[model samples]
Target: MQRKSWKKPALIVAVLVAVAMVTSFCRSRETAPAHGNGAPAAVPIRVAAAHRGDLDLTLKVIGRAEAYSTVNVQARVSGQLQELLFKPGGHVKQGDTIIRIDPSLLQAQLDQALGNLAKDEAQLVNAQAVLKRYSLLIGKGYVSQSDYDTYKANEGLYLASVKADKAAVELARTELSYAQIQAPFDGIAGAPLVYPGAQVTANDTSIVVLNQIHPIHITFSIPETGLAGTQASMARGTVPVTATLPGTKLPPMQAELDFINNAVDITTSTIQLKARYDNHDDHLTPGQFVEVVLPTTRLTNVVTVPVVALQNSPLGSFVFVVNADDTVQQRMVSAGPSSNGQIVIEKGLSGDERVVTDGQLLLVDGARVRIVTGNG
Candidate 1:
C-alpha cells in the first residue's frame, strides 16, 4: 500500500512540471520580437527620388542697410545764413537749393571786382594809345628817350593789371556761387544746422545733412572660409542676393552682389560684402538691420534629396537609400547648403537612388519598406 501511494505522488509532480514549462514557453514566444522568428515586416515609408540637377549653395547672414551716399551740407564760404530754402526733413533732388547765405556782401564784392576790371581796361587802352604816340614821336625825335621808355613801361604794367583784374572777377563770381547750397544728390535733407541769420564759416560748420535712400546698399559679412566660393561665383556671373526687412510686410528685395572687400577682417575672420538694390519705393532705410540671402555657387549634375530625408544618428547624418528590391540601406552622406526644401548630397549618392523622406523611425539597416504615395 505504501509503494502505490508514493507512485501516485510522483505522477502528480510530473504533470505540474509539464504545465509550468508549457506556460513559460508561451510567454517567451509572446515577448520575442516579430522579426527575430521570421522575415521582417515591411515598414511603410514615404520616399523621394534623388535627381541630378543644379543645386544653389546658398548662405544667409545678418546685414545692415546703408545709404548709397551721405552728405553734410557745410558752408564753403563764410557768411550769414540768409535763407533756409528747404523745410526740415524735406526730399530734395540733385542741385535743389537747400540753403542760401546772404549774397548782398558777395554781390557787392562782385560789383567792385567788375568796376576795378573796367577801370583797368580803360587805363590799359590809354596806356596803349600813349605808347603808340610815344613810339611815333620817338621815331621822329619829338619826344625824349626817357619819356618814351616810361610810356612803354606803363603799357606793360597796365596789361598785367588787366589780366589780374579779370582773374579777380572770376574769383568774386565763384565766391558768389557759394552763397547758395544745393543738394549733391537725390536725398532727404535734415534740418539746417545753421539757421537763418546765424554766422557760418567755410567748411567749419554743418549747414544740413543729406542721405540718399533710393538705390541703396546693404553691407554684410561672411566667414573667411566662404571667401573663395564667393569670389568664384562673382567671377562666373552676377551673384544673386536678397534682403529681408524685419517688421515690414514688404517682399524681399532682390539685388546683385556689388562689392567685396579686398581684405578680410583679422579680428572677426570675416570678409565684408555689399549688395546694390533699387529701393525706389523707399521701403528700405539707412542703418536698418536686415537678413541677407545669397547664392554663392551652383553645383551641376549633383545628387539632391529633400531636406526631410536627412537623418541624424550617433555616427553622423545619413539618409536611407532604397535599393531595387525595396530594401532600405542607411547611407551616410555629406550634405551641403539646403535651399527650398532640397539638400545637396555631396557624397554617398549617385543621383539615381530613392531616398526615404518619412517613416525613418521604423527602419533599420537592410529593412524592407513599402513606399507610400503620401508622407507617412
Candidate 2:
C-alpha cells in the first residue's frame, strides 16, 4: 500500500512539470518577431531645405557671337596697290583712305578723254557754223536742198560725237576717283591681303576685312515651347537679354533683343534670335561661342521646390510631403520652368508645406516618419 501511494505522487509532479514546459514554449512562439525571407528595405536619404527667394525665370542656351557689321574691303578698280595707308589691325573711320592704287594710269586716261572732248567740242562749233552757212545758202537758193540736208546731217553727227566724248570724260573721272580705296565705316581693319606693288583685281580676294566692334550681336536659339512667352514679352515692350563667354564663368553682359526669326527652324526645331549689345569696350569678338539667357515672366507667390523632390510614376509627377505628425503624404504637383536647379511648383503645394527632397523615392503614402533634427 505504501509503494502504490509514492508512485501516484511522483506521476502527478511529472504531469505538472510537462504542462508548464508546454505553456512556456507556446508563449515564446506567439511573442517573438517574425522573420522575412526577402531583402531589407532601403534607407531614406536625409536632405536639407531650399530657401524660397525671388526667383527669376531665365532661359539658358548656347550660342555663337557675331559682328553687327562685317565688310570685306575689296578694290573696285584693278591696279597695283600703291600704298597701305592704315596700319593693320587698327581702327579706321568712314571715308578714311586705306589703300592707294597707282592713279597715274587713270589720270592719263582722264587727260586723254578731256583732250578728245575739247577736240570734239571745237569740231561741233565748226560744224554748227557750216550748218548755219548752209541754211542761209538754201534760203537764198545759193545751195540745193540736198546740200543743206547733208550739212544738217553732218552737224547732228558732230553733236552726237561731242556727247559721247563728254560721257567718256565722266567715266575717266570716276575711274580715277576709285583708285583711292577708302574705309566704308568705323571699324577695325584686318590683315592686309596684298602688299605694296601687288597687283590686285576687282572681285579677287578682299584687300582687308573690316568689323564694327562698338555694337555687337549675339545670336542664340530657344526651344519652340518658349515661343509664346518670348512673343508676349516682346509685345509688351523691350526685353533684356544677356550673354556670357563659353568655358568662362563670367558675369553676363546685358543686351537687347533686336531680331527674332519669323518661323522656327525645321532642322533644329528651335527659334533663332539675336540680341544687340553696345560693346563700347570691344570686349566681345566675332565667332566667340557663348551662353545666352533670356528672362521670361516671373511667377508671383508660387510654391517653389527643389528638383530632386519630384518623383515620376506611371500616374504622374508626385512629391512626398512630411506632415506635422511625423508621417508622409504623397501629393501630385504641376511643375513650371526650372531655374538655378530649383523648380516652380504651379499646383498641389502650399508655401507652408514641408517636403522631402532627398528621400522621396523611399517614401509611400501614410508612411511613418521621424523628423530628423538639424536635417532641414
- On TM-score, the candidate that comes out on top is 1
Which candidate gets the maximum lDDT versus the true structure? 1
Model 1 collision count: 0
Per-model TM-score, in order, reads 0.80, 0.68
Clashing pairs in 2: none
Candidate 2 structure lDDT: 0.81
- Candidate 1 lDDT by residue in tens digits, 51-72: 8898777888999999889998
Q: Per-residue error at 286 for model 2, in Å?
A: 0.6
Per-residue lDDT tens digits for candidate 2, residues 1-376, read 8768899889999999999999999997777644344323333544445345556677988887787899988887888889999888888989988889999989999999999999989988998999898887788889999988888888898899999999999999999998898888888888888798898896774788899877888989998888888887888788899888766766679999988999999998899999998988776888888888897665566678888877888988878887676677888888777876788877888666777866665677986565554644
- Model 1 lDDT, residue 43, Cα: 88
Q: Can you tell me which runs of candidate 2 are displaced by over 4 Å?
A: 1-56, 246-251, 296-335, 340-343, 348-376
User: Residue 323 CA error for candidate 2 (Å)?
Assistant: 16
* Minimal lDDT window, size 10, model 1: 32-41
